[model samples]
Target: MKRDRSGHFLMAQNARVLYVPTTKVASSTARLLLAEANGTYRPERLRWTDAPNISVDQGIHNLEVSGLQYFEFLPETQRDHILKSSNWWRVGLLRDPYARLYSVWENRVLLRAPSPWLKNFQHKCSEVLIDGRLDYAASFRKFVNVLRAEPEIFGDDPHFKSQRTHLGGDQVAFTHLFRVDKPGELDIFATQLGQRVGMKIEPRRLNEGLGLKHLDVMDAQTASVVEQIYEDDFDAYGFERVSFPSISPIALASVGETKAINYARDVTARLVQLSQLARYRQRSRYLLAQILRNSGLRRHKKHR
Candidate 1:
């Protein structure tokens, strides 16, 4: 799971659709939709009673909980068929490189989202977290610098890794590649996917981690580093580059306000995660059940 090419690729065999999820590109929304199509999206299965909907929404990333099929788990013959057959709609979602990098900093570094991989980042770039305490701009710049020094150090953790790494370049031959940043693209996809599945399929959005714009934190130096890091994405996706003014007082104030609110949210989420971990036996049983279900050792009827 920590490797550069961990098996994040998924597919809906019945729908004849293959999905290559690029992190931070509405990938969660796409995964939920595909799970629905596969008749395996069971919100009740999450069993996090405190906030059922939110917990289930976030759980879509788990292949076992979501009940979606991992493309890598399929047989070679089946994988070949899905890739070659025109019947299968191989889908991908893209985002602006600039926007995507900023999101990584804002959500993972700034908001301190509760994730297992988060600790690895903190240990590697402690400066980002320490500087983040007082100066958001300096923290972001430090993060970009760390990323430039060792781009693949996180082992292709989806959040910090390039979209190109996940997309499986040339081998995937994605039939439908949509830019999530573009207006109405996801809506169009929703309609198309709904028609294919014979039901309404709305793209579920989550993790609106920050209200402040990327320009608020990013400066010329940080922006330049981001460009260098993700230049391939801009060229391959044909996304136009954007410029940012060095500073904006109004935006800076907004960043400060948002930081305070997000800090509280992050602490709450971490406390919840800790609470779950406290129930050692219950947590162990739950994880065992999930693994059994995912590995086909236990029977779980597909949800439609």
Candidate 2:
């Protein structure tokens, strides 16, 4: 709220950009660029270690919930520093709600399958009703129901009746909001941000190609259902419905290749290690059994 001279200059020139990373958006790519630009931009360090430069514990909403007090938690000088920090911009990326929901499902399929206590309690409604069948509509309904039932979790305040009305009050705070649909707009945003920060940043790809898995298989009916469920997000973000052409073999092959590569590079490492450990354990058990049998034979011979 308190804008210093340099802050004003940056705002006038480009505006301070704070990127609120939402799941499934091109947040990773954006973070990478920011880190390259500013050595201070470290997501993992902020999340894990209590890094001084970045406050990862309190998200945008937390700042809004406890404004000056939130800042006061840091040293008084640090609070002042943040207030006067120049080229400080706040921005966030949000996705088509339905698409985001689908991505959440795909990414967390295993958690939802067994209905673990944490997953069940936290995301009961979103559970698949039938095994091996993905009912998008049903899932959406359950999600909505969960939100409605536990308003406090999604609501701006525990006392607020409607979360939507309470948005932007003291819970949801941002200077600029960018929709994932308009990627070109992000380039313009990045250029402006560069000017403000007095640093050059090439706009690399943001959240693209993430929904490829569902994009090909997402039927018109399912898409329509998603559109209806996430109409609010679509309207807010100006998301236009994208209709894919008939699935081609070439397209399918490309998708498969990409997935395979990602799995091999990112997923296989852990699995391979686990497999080796299991094999070792099995071999050890077999050797122990053989040793016990040989000992038993020796005892029998001595007794005879």
Candidate 3:
């Protein structure tokens, strides 16, 4: 898939660095940081416009990272090649699945600040706004359910896409993948890149939509659903399943007085496993085809 590189990805030939942004993972800061490294960032034009009605009200805006000149724009072919080559320094920002989901629920589902689809999602789910606000927990429950059923819907949106998807999953790899929990790594990355490019770069946090209502009392069923949905994330990043309060194991489900919540969790978990297996099988087939094609071409050239 061709990504919008200007804002979603970053490059610095001087630093020989490429950065892929994972939403809610200090992506705004990384974008500006790389833009500055490439001399395209305009801090003066950066303004915080908070019109609650508009999505841009929450984060930094007006910095056209792509419009500014850069050492290079990383194209799909080039990015794929470079990520696999050790010669080029590749980096990406990743977050803990649990923490990232919490942040998404707080800022995106509850506040509906950036995502256009999310604005009307609550209404579609019969979650009416009370004094211009819907219950965050109820909205988040719906959000998680939808995502579990249709993971493909998240492919285009960075906020909801799996970190593996952004980092090329099993298709391509990065040289240095940093975690959000380990914030000091950002500083380390900045310093390393600065030395490479012969410039000074100071890492700073940007667009942390904090002060929003944080979910401190998540029930067991919701937690189970999240764990199953983000199973890939947990396995890929070596993250442990975080424990949240589960009021009653059996009370999680009762669907109009039908199946138990635990039953739903089991189904979601199995589905996620099957999806992962399918992707892995597909990747294996792709690799085998490439190998065969390359071998045939080599034999033809030898005969010639």
lDDT of 2 by residue, 3-102 (tens): 3212211111122333444545555445554444443433343332211211232221222221212222345585344445553555556555545655
Which residue pairs collide in model 3, if any? Answer: 253-261
lDDT of each: 0.73, 0.44, 0.59
Off by more than 4 A, model 3: 1-8, 44-63, 66-81, 116-119, 124-139, 149-155, 212-215, 248-304
RMSD of each: 6.4, 15.3, 15.2
Question: Over the stretch 140-191, how does candidate 1's per-residue lDDT look in tens digits?
Answer: 6778898899766665356887788779766788889988878989888888
- Per-residue lDDT of 226 in model 2: 56
lDDT of 3 by residue, 122-145 (tens): 443343233444444555566777
Poorly placed runs, candidate 1 (over 4 Å): 1-6, 48-54, 123-135, 150-156, 246-304
Task: Give the candidate number with the greatest lDDT.
Answer: 1
The C-alpha TM-scores of every prediction are: 0.78, 0.45, 0.62
Clashes of each: 0, 8, 1
